[model samples]
Target chain A: MDEFSFINSIKQSTYKQSTLLKGVGDDAAVFRQSSKDIVTAVDTFVEGIHFSRKTMDPFHIGNRALAANISDMAAMGASPVFYLVSIVIPSHWTEDELSQIYRGMQSLAKQYKIDLIGGDTVSGNELTISITVIGYAACGKARYRSTAVEGDIVFVTGTLGDSIAGYHILMNPGQFINKNYYYRRHQMPDPRVAFALELEDLQRVALNDISDGIANEAAEIAEASGVSITINYQQIPTSDSFSQFTVNQQRNWPLFGGEDFELLGAVPKRDWPLVQQAAQRTQTMVTEIGYVDIGKELVYLQEENGRKPLNKKGYTHFKQVKL
Target chain B: MDEFSFINSIKQSTYKQSTLLKGVGDDAAVFRQSSKDIVTAVDTFVEGIHFSRKTMDPFHIGNRALAANISDMAAMGASPVFYLVSIVIPSHWTEDELSQIYRGMQSLAKQYKIDLIGGDTVSGNELTISITVIGYAACGKARYRSTAVEGDIVFVTGTLGDSIAGYHILMNPGQFINKNYYYRRHQMPDPRVAFALELEDLQRVALNDISDGIANEAAEIAEASGVSITINYQQIPTSDSFSQFTVNQQRNWPLFGGEDFELLGAVPKRDWPLVQQAAQRTQTMVTEIGYVDIGKELVYLQEENGRKPLNKKGYTHFKQVKL
Candidate 1:
């Protein structure tokens, strides 16, 4: 098999899908959507930088890249229609690994009903994966960070920092035996696509996905909306794996160590109950984290102390060390 | 510094001059063209698989990825408009390299009269770049690979294999002393945006760019249009680099090597004279390779052998070779 054969294997499958008007053979994938065709998101993952070749599996890397980008689409309250992927792999890789990566991507894409319209692959210095996801939303209804209200309640889906912990498990496999949950979190950070699609017309749900940890992403929403935020530390949801870490380590990881592809949202006070009910209808949890307020700074409610300024920051590529 | 700050520093100069409805801060970019609507194309480049860090500089890799995709719009005879780039850098890279890569992309974008709209940046293991370029073709005309006819004279812009030779030169920089031409070819393989825009109503002139070299791209156009192709080897435009290589090498490099981002087109035989005049007007040469025939084989006309079967296939990713 040759590189074109490998790329064509993917193209052949995606090109014939009914939803794609134009696919692998063309300059761009063209589609017709009922709602506004205004939203598109592109995300990239590099080997050694995003994943360790020594510890990470190619299948998981491919699945993770696709999932992370789709999560971005969900954050906008948009329904993803199609995607274009670009991959650069080291020339030395085997066909099996390449096929495994595609299989992983196909698995998630099937679940989301996302049509993999087109992508490019060529030889490069390292392995790289980039995916551009296009989604649709009703005009004027797509969510944005800039629209959060001063008195809105903040919500998050699932738990936080387990994906980071999964990385830890990969780095030190002997230390972790909770393979089922951590492995799932790292390989498949759920994109909340159905939830986003359902919330498109709700008007009060301002949404974003947690790519750069909860605190960092929340800070973006707060800054964009020109409002202060307050998080009750005790209320921040966590899974058992997350809770097992030392207090300072947990706080730091939860606050900064990103790559947590969870959905974070804000809703008006009046709509909170309705939003929760809506999630119940969809069979998903909507955990309340905190509230938005009219002020210049974010505050953390501590049990020992009344309140204190929270350092609202997340993973920095330039930072020297990790939590 | 935090992740947000890193993003802000990198976002400082990008899209500063763009008439972006919403730029990097938003979920997706919003832009309008004179045609009142838009068309988009997304292409991604992966490291170690598409290019070699040892052979290609970051600036050229960044610039060429953008330019090659823009050429896709050019093939549609579309005017360049706006682009969104998603870059995944290795975690170990420095700020200087990132800025330089963007600078290279921005420089090319400025020349093409397009805006750098919005993009997402993340740290990954291998470098991956995905760019979705949005451009406009007058409502009724966007050239496609599926439109070609018997007797249409095949035409190509610039020379083939120069970029390939340039890659070779870069991989072994010590081999050549007079590196000016090779260096330029490696860094900037011109996008025929102006030439493509000139050939309006591409129904009369089916077109595709030569990203995967002329032979492979021509085969694609032929296969898509259900037409047999014939190319005159003598008529294939060549550069000084062609003279340095063996005849077999010249043929192989021009036919199979990827990264030659030139334009491959088909125009009416009757318009041959006019095409020559237009080439002169644009100061870009248009070499007539061959024409469409009745059957399915892609043939080549050699000086001594007259018409002969062209059997060598172009570059394929599955070919077993060590990087």
Candidate 2:
């Protein structure tokens, strides 16, 4: 199909939101924001830098792109409502592959009830997808990275470091046992949107999505809020398969193996019970891994040996730069 | 500079909009929408596909990217407000070039009183910049291409053909007599946001920003609204330098050479006076180029000899595909 016909077939189904007056067939998409703050973020994934065709299909690439941006909205304590994708296609990309990419995004968007509002498509030398996610939060209630306060309990939802372990198994096939488990973990990240939304009623909370690894995200919170953090290594939750990996993998992957799409949050002690209740209601695994304290801005891991500063830089082989 | 520090120096000044609760240092930018419908669009510019470093510099490239999106908002009869830029940089680009590119966007954002919210930056094989612009219009007032009605007076603000004329001169240097006029027309587009916003109170109006040339844009309106359009060739406006171009240039450039960033609107004959007053107040030159009629969906241009079908596809030298 030509580009216009392709656009006509782009939408998977009619959207349910009455606020979305216009979708794909206009100069711009129109949506009414009824008394809420809009939270939006953009994420880009390039072919060679972020992924290769050998490990991920076109569907997964699109899924991964949209998943990352939606996770950003979840991190801000907002209910994701709409998304736009701006993609750069190489000359060789087939329409079928393009369709698979969109299908991947639509499938994930369906889970969150998010509308695929509009986007831009262009031809270039490599496949690059940038997704912009817009969500709504109650007035002045969206969480921020710089809002972590002293005495806040630092916690995370879901297991940490699975994506990195999955990454290792996928990159070097036949090197690890139980392939499907790791494959799903790396390929299809379940964004922690429901868990993040559950905590919206809490009075004091700070959240950051784990696109970067746990250690790096903690450091960001520390740096942004001017608070010290200490994550107890033993308290960090992991899967049963984590024991089968090498010690180096166990030590570093959970800390630096990014793309986890989990929520790392900090909440005051009075709000901790509410956070825990929300996690339970959402069926998410919650673990109290650390605490915020008054000190110089720094993040430390409380390992068996002693307290050691967490490396702010995560795994660098795949990601070169991000902001 | 590294990406993070570059982000620190990004803002020209702290944003003035109180509705923007949070700006750059969060998981997402948060803003309160005061009962207005949100209008948003995404536009991407890729190296070689859109423009090369030879024809346009980094600043002009950034300016062009944002201008295109802003014009999309204007086309929908919305006021341009906030913009986010996601850029992919090649390894060879200098920090100075990247900064200049941002300087271009910041300068334009300043002019429109728009805020620089947030974006993603990454590395790739070639430079790619995708911008998402968000604007607001009164509830249910956002216009669409599908709204042109029969008997509406079709109009356009400003001259149509300068960008294509400028593109030729810039590509083949010293061939044209007036260099600056054409150069500025191609490099710097004055988005018709002011004139578009001026028609806010009009009872019935339809608009489209002139990005895909007058012919293609009108065809879109014609096809979307299921109306026939007839544009008088003599009625199309042009600059003084236009008279010096070749007959073929004169014939095609005005209809096919896009990126003028002017507003093409359709309004009821009764409301035409209000549109004219809006144009006069904004210092924009308005022209009655055509009329919308009930018929088979098609677009035509009437000339001295007779009426002819307008080519739907515009100039193909610079742009390959856009949606």
lDDT, candidate 2, B1-323, per-residue tens: 65556767775358866678888877889988877889988888888867777778899998888888899999988988888888988878887888889888887888998998878778788899999999999887898888889999999999988987888888777656678988888888899988888888987678888888899899889988999999999999988878788899897888888889888889999999999999999999999999999988789889899998777875332134344
Native-to-model Cα distance after best TM-score fit, residue A118 in candidate 1, in Å: 2.1
Candidate 2, A66-168: lDDT as tens digits: 8888899889989889999888888689878988998889889888888988887787788999998999988878998899999999999999888878878
Runs in model 2 lying further than 4 Å from the true structure: A175-177, A314-323, B314-323
For candidate 2, what is the recovered fraction of reference interface contacts? 0.68
Give per-residue CA lDDT, model 1, range B200-287, as digits (tens): 6334777888876676777777777888788888788877646777678787777766566778888778887776776777788788
TM-scores, in order shown? 0.84, 0.97
Score residue B319 of candidate 1 by CA lDDT.
Answer: 26
Given candidate 2, what's the lDDT at residue B178?
78
Clashes of each: 32, 0
DockQ of each candidate relative to the true complex: 0.30, 0.60
